[model samples]
Target: MIDWARLQGVYGPAHDVPTLLQAAGNGAKEAWDELWIQLWHQGNTCDAGIAALPALASLAQHTNRAVRFPAIELAGEIVGAGLREGRPLEKMKELHQPVAMLSALADGWLSERPAGYRVCFRAKLALDGFPVLSDVLDDFLDFCCDVSCPQCSDKVSIVIGDFGCYSSIRDWNLGDVHPIPLRPAAPDDLQDAAQGLHHAAIRDEQPRLAWGLRHVFGDAECGTCDTAFSVLSALEAKRSPSTEFQENAGAATAPAGHDEGKNRHWPAPPF
Candidate 1:
């Protein structure tokens, strides 16, 4: 039993998750829109979405193609995709999760659930069509969010706008705002995390994230801007994955520009 309360969605505590999911199953338009906002957030990733994926994946058999495809794509991206360059493909495989999930999504609807050991792919599931969009670098670069750096994600519009330190990005940036009093792992903890966040923005082109860091940058008293920049500079000092992503950037999760947030919402099924 997963503790849904422990997770955070783009808007608030992941309220209405089960309900929204149910509504999605029923082909509710508002449900799909909210789901997209909660899961991807203007094209950026959301941890809440990642956590719920295993649950959402079950809806693969849903009659609504929008529901099925988005669920598959979102879940697939987290298990090893989205930002495309994420460590999941290697990380989850090392942990062992995708195959079964994919197998189920691919064939679960066709027949009885495969046995515990017999859950082989009756047919290969191709993720190519779902293209995870978080890998693009320029998407995170520029923004109109000179107002703030995302300290809180209070949606001032139909969807969330770029407000730093105020929102979430489940699968996009390096510096996450979860756990309130955020901390680092080890070694170059702050720097590495900072670098990772900045690099993800610049490298992935997650402009909202990029500008969020810029928001943090403007907070001189916080001293995070200089720190993040120093980390970025050091990262630049040494050629690494950031370079690789830059040289061969792929699809952007969000569109580039001010407050555009790379808006991507699922369309309703045609009657």
Candidate 2:
């Protein structure tokens, strides 16, 4: 039994957490909204968030689809926060079994729901202990974000949507000042976490997400200074203090006969 009163959340005490979670399990939307704000406001997880993992996992495992999906997502976010703050889940012995349970549930769900690829993939990354990459790919749907150039401190906007995958410095009055196209990694060139995620997307029939992963793990040049850098490296450097993903770029150069021509026609179910 958890003494919620002794633990702290974003608020002073976590006494209300149990009640909120109970309400959430019963499909109370307000309870979910309040719990999200209190336990994980703006991606910052609290002690209460960690303490509530088992309950969240139980809800995710037994509840109806409406509650299960968000429950798992919230649990994943909470787990990811530990790593983002330089605390890997491996060190938190209390959470090991709960995380393992969630991972097993997610693995089973992924095979049945290819349409929920992004959400499922994020949970997979979190369960696999990659907080930074999971967080960066959270915006995979939007397919755009601004990263300050480490070389010249210029704001470079990266676009990885249907229009194309490329980096550019945008001027509101001028538009796409010096656009540089992204060099997507070939399937064989993707390494480690990138390769795993791409393969999962492809296997799950999320071709669009799989294609985007190539660019995400590929290389790009700074639009302003022409300095070449790994796109994944630049993105990782900008998001968190972790440089662990730098090695996820695979080989430095794309192989001689890489082809992106087969990267079209996304037939996955729409979210």
Top of the candidates by lDDT: 2
Candidate 1's residue-wise lDDT over 144-221, tens digit each? 111111223221100112222222222234322231111112323335334444443355433454443443322211
The estimated TM-scores of all candidates read 0.36, 0.70
* Number of the top TM-score candidate: 2
Q: Report the number of backbone clashes for model 2.
A: 0
Task: For candidate 1, give the lDDT of residue 168.
Answer: 23
Q: Residue 254: error of model 2 in Å?
A: 25
What is candidate 2's TM-score against the reference?
Answer: 0.70
State the displacement of the C-alpha of residue 113, model 2, in Å, after optimal TM-score superposition: 1.6
Q: Lowest-scoring 10 consecutive residues by lDDT in candidate 2?
A: 247-256
The 0-to-1 C-alpha lDDT of every candidate, in the order given, reads 0.39, 0.72
Candidate 2 lDDT by residue in tens digits, 1-271: 8888889887678899999999999988899898788787766888888898889889888658878877888888888876676655688788889998887777667767657767877887787666666776743443666677778888777766643566777766565555677888999987775676677777777777777778778877788898777776677566653233333222122112322346432222133
Model 1: what TM-score?
A: 0.36
